[model samples]
Target: MNAVSTTSAERVRADLVRARSARSARESLIKGLLFLAALLSVATTTAIVVTLLQQTISFFGEVSPLAYFAGTKWTPLLSGDQQSFGVLPLLWGTFYLTGIGLLVAVPCGLLAAIYLAEFAKPKVRKTVKPILELLAGMPTIIFGYFALTFVTPVILRDVFGIPVSEFNGLAAGLVLGLLVTPTIASVAEDAMRSVPQSLREGAYGLGAGRLQVALRVVFPAALSGIVAALILGASRAIGETVIILIAGGQSPSMSLNPTGSFQSMASFIAATARGDIPQGTLKYETIFVVGFTLFCVTLLLNAVSTRVVSRYRQVYE
Candidate 1:
């Protein structure tokens, strides 16, 4: 009987050893996979930066950086014409449109976020939030067409009687505002909701009104996130390609007026890349130079967002 019990104990111990070995092997495999994913992401970003730098260097070899940056005209592809590489016109158009878009998006998006976060009932919020986010998923091309067909002709021309061009910055910027509104609303609302319930209750105990509480306590608490949301909206406006390409004309001009047709940096890149500019030409290299400039702008915006968040972020137990 003793011998039989010893043999059974040995068998049980052997089984336990096998299970531990299997678990360790599985854990090691998962760790390897996670490491590989992180490495791949870093590698991809490095490759993009390297490629853009290579082309940008070649571009600057022939064209003066001052001419590329400060020249008022951008007519490199004009046949039999003195080539101009000044990026100011494109920069102006990009920032002008983005400013118009922000004018429309900021107030409207903030109000919507306030309503959803503070006042809306649970049922309404659940139904409305998803529908609002759905607007973001709609194709930008459709928005472009809407601007060209309905906005320019029916609304701007008929109702307002503004002498807007067929493809103007105002319509494109308005449509771009509508496109990014949901993004701002969603992010801002989440930020506001993240404020602790205790703060709201304390404000109520002081006999503060709902509006005062929302604006004073909650808004301040969520300022970091709100600023981040605005920065994100600006980045989206700056990087947009299709809406501007379709609605905003490809004409590069230094016009500050939104009623005029103009070309944004992103739109120029897309329009030029699609055309028959042969590889290795100055015109072709302009694509990368413009792209690098855009990349730097976006990186700066992200850095600002990080700094703002760090400065203003609140911590609660």
Candidate 2:
């Protein structure tokens, strides 16, 4: 009897060992696949950086960086006397558009998020949130056309009497604001929702009003995430190409007036791509330089988002 029991115990032990070994093998395989996925992303980013840098070097070889940075005009394809390579005008155009977009988006999106997070019933949020996010899925070119046809003619020119031209930054910026509203609202709503319910309850228990609790308790707790959402919205605003290209015009000029027509970095790139710029020419190289500049700006925004999130995020047990 003792010998039989011993044999059965050893068989059970061997089976358990085999099961653990199989699990170990499966885990190793999953880890390897995850590592490969990470490597693929890294490799793609490296390739983009290398390609941009190589052509940007060619651009600098043709033009002085000082002239590129300081020159106010961006007429790179004109005759000898007309040609200039000033980058600031286009950069400023982009900044102006993004600022206008934020000006419109920040208030509307935040207010919408506050309503949805702190005041809306569950059914109302469930219905409204999806509808709001649906705006994000619309084609960008369609938004461009909407800006051109509706916003320029109906809103900025007529309703507000802003004196905006047919192709102006004001139209593009306004439409871009509507386009980015979903992103800001969704992200901010999620962040506000993530605030601890206990904190909200405690505030309510202390006889705090809904507005006061929302502002004092939840808003500060989720501020890092709110800032991140705003950064992402700004990033979307800056990276927009189609709307600015179509509605904001393709003519590069330096002017701060939102009512004026101007070209963004993205619009400039698109304009050049469609024109007579020959391959490997200075004009072509300028595109890569502009692209690199846009890349740097985007990277900076992402870094700021990371810093804000890490610095102010609240810890909960």
RMSD for all candidates, in order, please: 2.7, 3.9
lDDT of 1: 0.91
Clashes of 2: 0
Predicted model with the maximum lDDT: 2
- Per-residue lDDT of 1-317 in model 1, one digit per residue for the tens? 99999999999999999999999999999999999999999999999899899999999998999999989999977645578899999898888888888899999899999999999999999998998889868888998899889888999899999999989999999988988899889889999999999999999999999999999999999999999999998999899888888888889888877777989999999999976779999889999999999989899999999999999899877
Q: Which residue pairs in candidate 2 have backbone atoms (N, alpha carbon, C) closer than 3 angstroms, thus clashing?
A: none
**lDDT digits (tens) for residues 35-75 of candidate 2:** 99999999999998998999999899889999999989989
Off by over 4 Å in 2: 1-34, 275-277
lDDT for 179 (candidate 1): 85
TM-score of each: 0.91, 0.88
Q: Estimate the TM-score for candidate 1.
A: 0.91
Local accuracy by lDDT, each model = 0.91, 0.91
